[model samples]
Target: MPQHLLLIEDDARLASMVAEYLEQSGFSVNHCGDGLSGLAHLTQPPAGAAPELVVLDLMLPDIDGLEVCRRIRALPAPLSTVPVLMLTAKGDAMDRIIGLEIGADDYLPKPFEPRELLARIRAILRRKVDNPAPNGKTLRFGTLEIDRDARTVTVAGAACDLTSYQFDLLVALAERAGRVLTRDQIMEAVRGRELDAFDRSIDVHMGRIRAAIEADPKDPKRILTVRGVGYVFARQQD
Candidate 1:
């Protein structure tokens, strides 16, 4: 079956164009003009059907796009876990950073090409469906435990709250514990793309992940930053 997508964009023209393009590309697209209605669609999806992804615009009629993204993240699981791709007209770095920090799976600046949008959507979906790690594999390091199949992480027996992207980032680091990976390496491994110059989305995401899994995010022990390099997952958690 074609994938289902919810597009929360206030621009009527843009929404119609995007919906048509995505539909031609073999997706079922539902468009909502405002944030509140969009949130409702996400929260109370059709009785038996829910969108596989959300393409959210940063500008909205009711609530700001950022707030909408937060509300989506706050939803109960499987809903909260749905991937979000943020669309913004803003070229500011902070906007993209904030979007990713708030659990958006990907970000696209406005006036983007339809093809690129399609590619990004495909990439995010790929990450959702493809599990690189062997099934049933679990990585244990002292108080931290990562279950590959379950896609869950726990520190000291307490479950950590992580977005889908954050969970993937953590798994990528833990799978190669003790080996330092550059930002390029980490992004490519988890996102299937190289880091964009001046884009600190990865760093923002790392900070969020640390906050979720580390006993003290300010001084993380599991994911250590290497000066002038990238980051590493400690082999020994003690």
Candidate 2:
């Protein structure tokens, strides 16, 4: 089946251009020009027509993209799992960081190279299929819990929603608790590939996971940064 893409951008020309390019790249693209309409379209997709990916624009006519992302995360199945790539004209690091902090799988500045957007989209999809830990499987460690099978994580049994990357990071650390895995090892284990740019995406994912599952993300107990080596999940004796 051809992968489906939902592009939510208010700019008519940009929306058309992206749809055409993505379709040319073998994707079935759907465009929603306004935030309210985008949410409406998302609420009612075609029969069994969940999108494989979403391209979200930060500035929307009705609601901000950040709010949309939040709502999407609050969704169940198909919609919640759909990978999102945020588009913003803001190039500042803070803006980029905010997008990531708000659960965007990836971020691209406006006037981005089409190829780069496609690369990111492909990378996210690859990670989604290749990672395979977010299908409602749960792994528990003391007060910490990871439910990949349901994609629902809990800290002290409190429900938490995690992105695909965040879930993989926790699983990597938890699955190898008490042992130090180098950043490279964690990357390979989570991404299933050798690093191309050696990006700190692993660290970013870890931050999000810890923020969700730890009482203190700054000083996490469940997942510990081992200074020079890498990271280890704090072993809890059964």
Candidate 3:
């Protein structure tokens, strides 16, 4: 069965092109002209027809995309955890960073190739299927626990809220704990394409991941920054 995708884009021409292109690429797309309608569709889909991913436009007719993303993350689980790939026309790096900080799995600047979009969508969905921990093993550091099979993270028995990409990033780092990894190595491990341009996005994701799993995001111990080198996941944690 084709994976379902919801495209919340106000541009009719672009939406038509994207939906048609994605359909041709073996994805079933449901396009909405505005953010509110998109949110409504996500909140109440027809039976089990919920979308597996959302292609969200930064600028929307109503509520804007950032607010819409915030609302989606505020929704109940499964719904909140849906992968989001943001489309931005601003061509601004800050917009992309802000989007990642607020739970978007990935972002593509406007005037992008349809193939890249397809690849990004595939990458996001692929991460969901690829388990880093072999045999569904759980990686525990101090009181923090990551269940590879469940795709969940908990600290001190409390659930940690992380986007799909952020969860994968954490796993990539934790699996190689005590080993300093450069940004390229981390992105490579996550299988996220086009890293040279979007390397800062990794820092944005790591910040969010630390905010989720680290007791003190300001002074993170588990995930440490090597200052100009990259980052390292401390093997020994309190």
Which candidate comes out best when scored by TM-score?
A: 3
- State every prediction's TM-score relative to the real structure: 0.96, 0.81, 0.97
lDDT of each: 0.88, 0.77, 0.91
Best by lDDT: 3
Candidate 1: Cα lDDT at 176:
88
Q: Rank the candidates by lDDT, best first.
A: 3, 1, 2
Q: Model 1 reaches what TM-score against the true structure?
A: 0.96
Lowest lDDT sum, 10 consecutive residues, model 1, at: 191-200
Give me the overall lDDT of model 3.
Answer: 0.91
- Model 2 TM: 0.81
- Higher-ranked by lDDT: 2 or 3: 3
Greater-lDDT candidate between 1 and 2: 1
Question: Which should have the higher lDDT, number 1 or number 3?
Answer: 3
Once fitted onto the true fold, the runs of candidate 3 whose alpha carbons sit more than 4 angstroms away are none
Steric clash pairs (candidate 3) = none
Compared with the true structure, the alpha-carbon lDDT of candidate 2 equals 0.77
Clashing pairs in 2: 135-149, 136-148, 136-149, 136-150, 137-148, 137-149
